[model samples]
Target: MRQPERERPTWTFLTHHARVLLEIARNPEVRLREVASGIGITERTVQIIVNDLRAAGYLDRERVGRRNRYSLNTELRFRYPTEADVPVRRLIDMFADRR
Candidate 1:
């Protein structure tokens, strides 16, 4: 017999900021709409999050022709005390595709 499906939790280990950063890292040329849709958030929220990341020095945005390209600042350290010494690259590598 098949087991019952487990319920999903309301919280996650990664925050919206991390999610946005990961998405941008995955595709630097990705549009806000695509990131929003992929992350299940509003485009406006993505815009705000991108701004936050930029202001925090975790992301760099550059205009590439008609679109914007994002570059991750992997050298930056995490904000939390527990992982404060860890670089952003470590977190990104955890979720990044191996192929």
Candidate 2:
């Protein structure tokens, strides 16, 4: 017999990179440690992801005082060729605060 669905699926739609981006999009000054806690991930992992994003031109990091600040490259399109034309701003906007 078929089994019932679990309370939560094992897979998620948004990638860690996407999650980090969205988090920063909402609050540019947010701390990476906070992002990790909010995302249920390790701070070191978040740091690695941030490095990847920066290397890929998805994010720009600036050191403001003691904490680092992030800025998204809104005009930059997705890396995947399938969605290369689609700017990441659309993705960010899709998950923007909705009330």
Candidate 3:
């Protein structure tokens, strides 16, 4: 029998960020716990990545009661393929209607 492909190391790779953003975009109201579970990464890493994205002007999230509403800026250009197709700012705007 063939063995299953091993999971990739998220920290060592950059595509993880894009993948994470896509997931968040799919469900703006996704919780940290759910994100960590869905992405197969630690919550700490999720927090770090999220902070990095915000710092890079890739995303903007608003506080909605106890949860957050995220927006994806699909206009700003990204330096890498991890953000090639979509703009960082566009992602932030996706949640504009939430708050």
The backbone clash count of each candidate, in order, is 0, 0, 11
Per-model TM values vs. the true structure: 0.87, 0.87, 0.67
- For residues 1-99, what per-residue lDDT tens digits would candidate 1 score against the true structure? 322336545678888899899998888999999989877789999999999999999999999899999999998999989999999999889885532
At residue 99, candidate 3 shows an lDDT of 26
The residue-by-residue lDDT of candidate 2 on 44-89, one tens digit each, is 9999999999999999999999988889898899999999999999
lDDT (C-alpha) at residue 36 in model 2: 97
Q: Give the Cα-based TM-score of candidate 2 against the true structure.
A: 0.87
81 Cα displacement, candidate 1 (Å): 1.5
Which window of ten consecutive residues has the lowest lDDT sum in model 2? Answer: 1-10
Per-residue error (Å), model 1, residue 94: 0.7
Model 3 lDDT vs. the true structure? 0.70
The parts of candidate 3 lying over 4 Å away from their true place are 1-14, 81-99
Clashing pairs in 1: none
